[model samples]
Target: MLVVTTACNLDCAYCYEGGGNGQGEMMDLDTALRALDLVAASNQPFHVQLTGGEPLLAGELVFRILEYIRNNNLPATTAIQTNGVLLDHQTARRLHSFGTAVGVSVDGLPAIQEQLRGQGAATWKALAMLDSERVPFSVTTVLSSRNTRDLSTLGMALHSMPAASAIGLDLLVQKGSAAAKIGVQPPDAVTIRSGVTRLLATLDVLNAQRSRPLILRERQTVLKALGRDEARPYCQACTGSSLAVTPRGELYPCTQTLGDARFHLGTLDHPRLSGTALPDGRLPKREECAGCGLQGRCPGDCPSRLHYNGADGAGLVCALYRTICDYCLYKGEIPS
Candidate 1:
């Protein structure tokens, strides 16, 4: 995931990239080119996640990077995670032509969304434009206290969006600034389970009448989580395997680890010195993982649940994990 630039226009309360306060020279074209070159040389396939404080805030740089990919014919599936507020007609056209999938960070309805994003109708305007242009996109709702009670309501709203293909529910973000700024906390396990249940229930109702209900990717992921044996590194958090390149050419295993010098793998010019980045951060292979009766074929991936207990996630999350699996399976979202 190339963190193209960290300079976002929105000052989201939960702005994880230090409120976009430290874009730090804002990723020069040279740095971006060199990073792309390195990826091309790897002879490996990757989906380039264009992220930012708000990537559209750096529109020119984004276009140039896309142009580079087209010119070189890089075997990369590209997508941009944008706030959608800045997705004007021209920008939307360029993105469609570039074959870049758009992921919008919209929390919920106007009052609910404005409470967190502070942009209100402007964000929705972008969503509308995408629909008008017939641009394919998805909605990423950061489920917060403001919208938690209305999970089903939010799901229904997303259902009405014209060009949106899926709904991504990030019930909460990190615990630092977002919590303090928005007066929000990560929903507890019980709260999370309830929200998912509510969301699935919403989908159930939709699928009942509509021949094709919109997909909730998180539900499918949770089912996969219920069946796991061996440990794989969490999605983009794995060292070296999944990477986030900073604007200044520095590298991190995941975008969440950006700004912290500890996870700073290295800069593009000196990537060989990234050995210190991992520092034995692998998930522990515990007895719970090894001895569980339905292990490998059950609860797949949950770095958050595991990290909730710190290094002792296996011991801490066992009962809660089982309860979730039971609940989801009973709902028939997961096949028996």
Candidate 2:
């Protein structure tokens, strides 16, 4: 995971990159290549995600970096997380050449999307360009109170888009720009669980009709619902095998800790690397979280948001997860 630049062309209200005033040092082509070389030397089945204030802003640079990775034979699969605002026909064609899987961060339809993501016309046009180019891309929705009510609308909108290969939903991480003013905060646990349940139901219908899979990221909920893998129900970011590098060439445990300097590891160009070197100091389960039956499955919610927003480790939004988990267990869907 690497954030190439802190700069973004759009000032989205819920921009999670806190320092992302869109004015940070951009990694030059050589810098990016050096990082890739370091990953290759480490002999790790690496995965790198290109993110930014907006990665597509560095379109040509991003393309060159991917080319360097392929040419060097790095054991890596690259993904780009873009706002889908800058993607045009030409750029989409270029991205397809690199064989990079694109994940577009779209919240919902024009009315809802513009409210949260802003730059409505641009994002819609970008999606159109992707569809026109037949570029295989996916949509990632940031589920929030504002968008929760419109989940079905969003699903339908994405379903209508032929180029979309998948749909993913992430609970709104209320921090940084997003927390400042979205007229709401991260929903209570009950709301998150209920909304996810609703969204998943809608997705089931969409998936049944289409060859493309609908991705609701309801793993924790669905897993709990089905009585499987309870303890590790949600995103086990650190426990999961993944690495992320920042634009400054520093490696971190994951992307959630990218902007923060404390999690910095050695630069990517160094000939020396250690698999066990990076720290995994994410919030440990508090007493409240530990006693809960769902604790075994949850990664304890979003650690970054908890750290940044001074949120209690146990939040109302998390209750929704617990509810879903318990429901699944009661139904004998998941193992006790």
Candidate 3:
């Protein structure tokens, strides 16, 4: 994940990047190029994720990176995670032309979005623009007390967007603005289980009726676990397979662990990226998770989340996965 810039245009209530108030630095062209070189040296199929406070905020830099990837024919698949408020027609066209997959952060339905991220109308318009341009994209919602009850409704809304191929539910990490006294929090285990149940049911029915199914990212993980597939790394950061570069070219295991010294590999000029050890140099094992039915099938929660929420964090995710796996067993027909 290349954090093109720490600056962002939005002040989301749950922004883990310290509200991305545009006070952060931007990545210069040299830093971005060096990061790409590191990626190329891996000699494996790589996924370059361009992210930031809002990557489009540094539009010129983003385009330059994209152009570099294209001109050099780098062996990499690219994507950009944006809030979608700045996804105008021209920006959308440029992104599509570059074959860059897009992931938009939207809390939920308009009202819920407005309450959390603000600029509900702008984000909605961006989704419409993506659909109009036929740009395939996915929606990522930060599940919290604020939007847990409306997961099904959010699914239904995304169901109408032809270009929306999936919805990824990310638990609220209690850091940055979310760590504030009045900040958003992850829903309780019960709320997550219930919300996930409704969401799975909604997606099951929706998939049964559509030629192109809207995938629930977490549900897919549950399905893979149920099938007893070999457990893959929870994320690039989990196994230290990917390096996240900050605006100033500092490197970490992944985007979520950007600032912590423990996860810091080194700077772009003197990278310390090596080995397969996790960012913390240890696999997170929880006593509570011992002997759970999901066990190895579930790769576990994000380390950064576990760090923020401690042992308590696992329960919420555990409830979610267990509900999905149990639901599939009960239905006897896992929805595609």
> Among these predicted structures, which one has the highest lDDT?
3
Model 1 lDDT-worst window of ten:
300-309
TM-score-wise, the better of 1 and 3 is 3
Q: Is candidate 2 or candidate 3 better by TM-score?
A: 3
TM-score for candidate 3, residues paired by index = 0.93
Model 3: per-residue lDDT, tens digit, 1-336?
A: 889889888889977767856677899999899889878987878888999988998999999999999999899889999999989989999999999999999889888888899889899989989999989999999988989988999989988887899999888777778778375777988898888899999999888877799998987777776677455666666666777899888988777777878778889888887742463322345564575556666757777777776656667777777777778778884534
Residues 1-336 of candidate 2: C-alpha lDDT, one tens digit per residue: 667877887666666666345577777777787767665776977777898878887887888888877887878888899988788778888778888898888887777777776777788788878887888788887766777666777777777667787777665555566657556456555566666666656766787887766555554454643453444423434353455666677776567666566655556655223441332323355555655555555644554555554544246435545555655556466555
What C-alpha lDDT values do all the predictions have?
0.68, 0.67, 0.82
TM-score for candidate 1, residues paired by index: 0.83
Best by TM-score: 3
Winner on TM-score between 1 and 2 is: 1
Residue 225 deviation, candidate 1, in Å?
4.1
| lDDT (10s digit) by residue, model 1, range 1-336 | 777777777767676555644343477788888988887888877678888878887789889999999998889889999988788999999999999999999887777778777786898888888988989788887755566566777778766665777887653435336536456555455555566667777877876665456777765655665555444444544344567788878887667667766667778888853453332233455665564443554433344333332543343334334444555667665444
In Å, residue 131's CA in model 3 sits off its true spot by 0.7
